[model samples]
Target: MEIIAEFGSSLLIVGCVLGFFMAWGIGSNDVANAMGTSVGAKALTLTGAILVACVFEFAGAYLAGGEVTETIRKGIIDPSLLASTPHYLVYGMLASLLAAGIWLLVASIFGWPVSTTHSIVGAIVGFSAVCIGSESVNWGKVGSIASSWVVSPVLAG
Candidate 1:
């Protein structure tokens, strides 16, 4: 509490910086992946793909990102448990952002296919289980998400 109080502004600043990096990572990896097919098919040039991605990314985020944002913000982890140690939650989130961002950057560089959602969720689950205890995590939600990872593609097929 005291630590957070003393460094609240600093934490917010750091969080914003990390959030920017995470968004950049998403743009580099996920956006590239999305636009790759078009580029490969020669349906669009690299510049065209980038321009299309930039517009649609913003539109998608603004229009449909709320549910996802909510799930990531409050669904996976139970915030009530962190009531006594709010700082831990803050630290965990910061760490998760940094970890996901780095993983995305590396995966993109290697041309590996990856989901940005999975990376961040994995980071959050890991940090919560290790730092805050397993009970702090909502296993049911985690299970649902994990099941979807397998089920969604199969269903699509």
Candidate 2:
């Protein structure tokens, strides 16, 4: 219970809380997407839809979510910099995650649907700007990523 007294355990607890919220959000959103057809066609009743969604969503979060987690691997930053000051890098990464999690949590609480990708990207930019200065951050990659907002839908449609 002494989260403040113990840094490692505090992080574990924080991670668990964040993980729960993240899983819940991902599941609920995906459930709507996956079951929309079934619900529309009346193939699955409302209760059936809810039950199937809750069960499969929990299973998917616990199993499939662990399949590929390279997104949190921090390969975006140079390895040499991490080695030089491990705590800074770790703190930065943790802070970025927490910031994004907080943003998502607040958004969900207020019933405002937002993209998790955008939340994470904003967090990364915040941390990168703080740690490496604005100049050190690559604007080109950021521009391209931002540009995709308009490009993807325009091309697909």
Candidate 3:
């Protein structure tokens, strides 16, 4: 649509803001989850954990985020399906980001410890299903992700 074209640049800004919000939510939740045990065991002080997370999150993203980012961007949903209407994909991604951020906020407020990965994945699935159709989604990948979510805590324990 003409509107999308006209405001394409603005959409980038919006995307960045949404991405920041989502990342913030994820970082807060994940760092707490990661450092909880250490703090509980008195192995690390709360301040130390916070400091470590601040440094390590940036380091981790800078050092190891690329492959995972690429895989998520390319493999999660077949973007080729929206080749002609790429704006839909943009809209869907934005919706997913916002959805995930809101989900994280609500979960935090309710004292329900939830995985940020699960929130984002569920948002992506819902957005893709509604925007593109269920056929466009790779359920096998989703299944794998779900299994990992279940397996991770057990493995950690």
Whole-model Cα lDDT of every candidate shown, in order: 0.93, 0.66, 0.85
lDDT of 3 at 17: 96
Per-residue CA lDDT of model 3 for 1-157, tens digit only, reads 5547898789989999999999988876788788888999999999998998889988988998997677567667788998888888888989999999999888877767788888888888888889989988888888887898899879999
Order of the predicted models by lDDT, top scorer first: 1, 3, 2
lDDT (tens digit, per residue) of candidate 2 on 1-157: 2323457776777667766666566545546667778999999998999999888867765886664244334423443444655566656767767777777667766766676667766777777677877654556766766787779879999
Cα error of candidate 2 at position 48, Å: 6.2
For model 3 the TM-score comes to 0.89
The better-scoring model by TM-score among 2 and 3 is: 3
Residue-level lDDT of model 1, residues 38-110, one tens digit each, is 9999999999999999899999999989988899989999977888988889999999999999999999889
TM-score of each: 0.92, 0.61, 0.89
In model 1, the number of clashes is 0
Show where candidate 2 strays beyond 4 Å. 1-13, 27-72, 135-138
Q: TM-score of the candidate numbered 2?
A: 0.61
Give the C-alpha miss distance for residue 155 in model 3, angstroms. Answer: 3.3
What lDDT is obtained when candidate 3 is compared to the true structure? 0.85
Estimate candidate 3's RMSD in Å: 2.0
Candidate 3 or 2, higher lDDT: 3
